[model samples]
Target: MTTQPDHGQELIPRPERTPEAVRVALARVAPHRISDMERHKEQALTAAIADGKIGHLRHWLTYWQAQVEIERRPDLSARYRAALTAVHGTSSNDDPAFRSAMNELAAVEAEAQRAVSA
Candidate 1:
């Protein structure tokens, strides 16, 4: 029912109604619509596919935290808390804020492991 602002043609619901809620949604499909993304979409798709695969990372992290001695290792506790906070903050994996939180948590695990050896 919606008409173009300048033209007499009616707007199609698919393109007009679909809001780009996530990067993957925008990258995989919206790329054709956006001139700037015409060059970057393939790269974005590759990165998005890899990034989307959590593969029980959150579960493993929780297990690592519980199995490790957090009382003796403060670093482990820090990682546990970081993961908990990250998971609690958002459910959307594509969200920028959530990605930042997860990246911070991912680093915490390595830092904790280093502490165990040191």
Candidate 2:
């Protein structure tokens, strides 16, 4: 049991031991608690690819890496990696365009990481 001051009048404090109340509070906070890097990494990559902003093969690779690293979602990561494989072709991972795209995506992902850290 606890007491709280209400403008100098004493009032009974609410108990903090309710499991249902705690769950509700956590649910309300979960979205803000999720790291921005984890939430936005895939959205950014999906937007870049859909908008033709990715200029090289490397963009796809770096995007895939971020999906693996930041997202850490195996199902979604596998799809992104498969798309990358389709775009750059397994035999031509050495392609320059692919490399450029991957590098550009890496830069974008690095910025996102900094943002999330901040």
**What are the runs in model 2 whose C-alpha is more than 4 Å off?**
1-91
Off by over 4 Å in 1: 1-71, 74-79
- The most accurate candidate by lDDT is 1
Instruction: Put down candidate 2 lDDT per residue, 1-118, tens digits, no spaces.
Output: 2232232221222223233332233233333423543444456667777887754333433433333232332333344455566546535658775676566555546743442233
Residue 44 in model 2: lDDT: 63
* Residue-pair clashes, model 2: 11
Candidate 2, after superposition: displacement of residue 46 in Å?
29
What TM-score, over all chains together, does every model reach?
A: 0.35, 0.27
Tens-place lDDT digits, model 1, residues 4-93: 223122122112221232222334333443444333445455555788854344333333322232322344445667776877789688
TM-score of 1: 0.35
